[model samples]
Target: MDLQTFMKDRKKLVEDALFSYMNAVKAPEVLLESMNYSLKAGGKRLRPLLVLATLKSFGKSEELGMPVACAVEMIHTYSLVHDDLPSMDDDDFRRGKPTNHKVFGEAMAILAGDALLTHSFEVMEDLLNYDVKPIKVVTLMKELAKAAGPTGMVGGQVADMEGEGAQLSLQDLEYIHRNKTGKLLGYSIVAGAILGDATEEQISKLEQFADHLGLAFQIRDDILDIEGDAAKIGKPVGSDTLNEKVTYPSLLTMNGAKEKLEYHIKEAKRILEEIPLESDLLGQLCDLIAKRDH
Candidate 1:
């Protein structure tokens, strides 16, 4: 199938399922509103889409991966919620609307973030229960915990906030992005690999692809900060520059960052090519990000 059609058909269902699960939480009403606000906010849904796409390519039913996909999105949304807080990026706007902390108080926003983070693990654990064996669920838990913990996404966040305006080195940028963004993206694919029962080699290949994919996403985000429209991006276009943040575009020229994005995209596709679990439509998905105007 063509990649656009494939993605269009699947993204809808993945998002629908994700939102429905969040809706069904039926937790305390106000807390649920805070959690659902950011969860339902507009995004490309790239993380969950990756989870579903990887699982699809590996012959797993999308339903089998739906819980994990929802979990990935929840973790992703949780990050965005915290990232916009006063103690963090301190942005008031996200996805063209007020951020969580802007709508709810900082404390409520913090609680919402905590709730989303904790609930994501619950969703993942439930997904693993669908697997054939106890060992499979245990393995899934291991992968999710590692990706979400201090060793991965959370570690990257701490470094990024603390390192801001510190004149970081190139290695520092890589370290932060690799963990903060890349690790969770890596777990999306790894989660798919485990659920789909991919071979060890395929899992490794997908993990590598995910790392490159995550870097590309971050680099493009940097580029967007430089060249993107404020209205489309839903925040100040020059905020990165305003913050004097160290980014690929700030360190190198815009053209140089573009080159790096292409390099990683090619690297990702090359890794995908070597894997027996090729999606045939993966290139379009990569290109979707690489060429996205918004």
Candidate 2:
């Protein structure tokens, strides 16, 4: 499967699934509006793409990818919504629009994040109805919970908020970011492996690729924050520096960050090359990661 097409198509799939799921909610008007506002915010939908494309590489149907894709994006979007809260990163805008907390009240934003986070599991239940083993579903859910909950995204967020303005050591920074940002990316690929019925070896290879690419993506994000076009990135330029957050670009020169990105891209490709049926689209996805503007 083409990575670009997978990303584009899977994103649309997730959007449709999200809308379909939203239709079932019997919440109050104010809560529903707040949830919609956060859910509809523009994003790259990278997590969902990772889940779908990885499954596609294994010749899995788009049907299996749909629920997992939607769930991953829901978890991701929830993270962003909370990240922009006044008590957290305190940003005014997200994906070029007012943040959930800004448009709705902070309380509602919190509730929205909570709802999306838990609703992801409900979405998954609706997705896998046949042919899949119950043990496999339970395993994947355990993995997702670890990656999205306190041991993963939330734990990372804790460090992020605490580390602000503090000059962190290299190890400290890596630990925070690897968990905060990288874990979800890691989870996306892992979900595909588990759901697609990949071998243990195949799962390991995909995990390695996702882990490296996730960090590389975050490094590129740091670079973009310093030098990216705000119009394209949709975030304030130099926001990292402004927040006194420790990042790759802050620790290394522009050329050094570029070198690190190159290093990871090579590593991602190298892993894929070792796996059977690893097509050109997988490599292209790494290339896209290396060259993404936003």
Candidate 3:
């Protein structure tokens, strides 16, 4: 199981579960179509992959974590759907296709995103059907809510919107991304650790690992905005500059940003080394995030 093969296998598994879960939802044809449209739109299923990968690292069955993995992905997709609306980032494309609002209209797109967000909890509750302990499921539900809610992604989004056209410090930029992007990513790993029955100490270390990994992920994204190919990234390059948002490269030059990315990758992998588990895949994932074109 090499890293690429492992990722391909897990991505397929997550995709199958996503469609299966979406098919089970009973809604108006238009709304359901809108929801499934974005849900099926192609992207690296990184958040869900993290869940399954963490479970595997702890010697747990990936099947047991499948529902949680899918649920997190749903939340992630919902956020993207909303993020593309006219009131938000106002992007016309995602994953190399017209965004949800573009294809479905703004009203339906909003409803579709709402459906995914609420439905994610229902999907997460399905973990009990796999005989996951009620307590663990309940705990995960709480954590997921916090991660996706105001204190997490939503809070980060609001801060980002407010910071637009304004000069932002690196600390402020970190605050925005740490909550906006990092919280959900951190949740992906933490969910697996909980279900995999990690010790408190190990969970703490993994959280630290997730923190560094999340920052590295965002920094690379900023780098890609300037240097990456639009075709591979699935969006126009220089969106950050076009939107007038401050980025790592803007705050600390391109070279400085790359150095910062390297620092976080080293720290993330260092934290992984201290955790007693089969974490080679996670280390590879860190490298992938650093070098990913999309």
Candidate 4:
């Protein structure tokens, strides 16, 4: 199948599974509504797609990886919900609609985000039912925790908040994006590799690929903020500047940022070439990340 067709089919599968999983959660009606609100809010299901794509690259069944894929997406959605809270980005819209806190109120929005985060682990436990080894499942769970916890996304977020409106070195900026945006992304690929029974060497190479891909992803995001249309990107352009957040373009200059984006894309694809698996899908994904407008 072509890359576009492959992504469309797998994206639908991920969306269906997300809806089913959210429907199974028993909670107060309003809380569930709040959770489902952001969960259903439209965005590229890139993280989960990465999981299934990595599995497919290794000739594993996508169904076997679905649980992990959904779990990772849940964690991602939860982060967005919290990130839009009054205490954080304070954004009023997401995916072309009111943000969770705006529609559900801040207290319920916070609870909903908490619910998604905790429930992701519960969803991951379902992996045991798929005949996956308990040890592998345990490892994935531990990795997911670390990726989403203090030393990863949360730490990056704290650093990003602290660095706002200040002059930050490129190294420091890279550190913030790698952990804040890259750790969970890296986890998605690594989880698939583990489930697909990748050799240790292949897993290591894929991790390196994911790291570069993650930075490329963030660079594209920064570029979009400058040149993207709100109708397509589903938010106001220039919000980063308005918020006093330092972006790649702001620090490196627009031309320099684009150059860095291309570098990361090339590096990610180069690492993919070194892996033994049929990694064309992953390579195509790297290009997509580099060029995605939203």
The CA lDDT at 188 in model 3 is: 98
lDDT of 3: 0.93
- Candidate number with the higher lDDT (2 or 3): 3
- Model 3: per-residue Cα lDDT over 177-221, one tens digit each: 999999999999999999999999999999999999999999999
lDDT (10s digit) by residue, model 2, range 1-294: 567776776677778878788779888888878887877885888888777777777777757877777888888988988888898778898888989998888999999989988888987776557466777878778888999888999999899888888888767877888899999899988898787788999899988998888888888888888889999998779978877788887777788888988998899899988887544666788888888999
In TM-score terms, candidate 2 sits at: 0.96
Best by TM-score: 3
lDDT of 4: 0.91
Q: How many backbone clashes does candidate 2 have?
A: 0
Cα displacement (Å) at residue 47, model 1: 1.0
Task: State in Å the error of residue 183, model 4.
Answer: 0.5
Give the Å error, residue 179, model 3: 0.7
| Number of the candidate with higher lDDT, 3 or 4 | 3
Candidates, ranked, lDDT: 3, 4, 1, 2
> What overall lDDT, based on C-alpha atoms, would model 1 receive against the true structure?
0.83
Evaluated against the true structure, the overall lDDT of model 2 is: 0.83
Candidate 2: which pairs clash?
Answer: none
TM-score of each: 0.94, 0.96, 0.98, 0.98
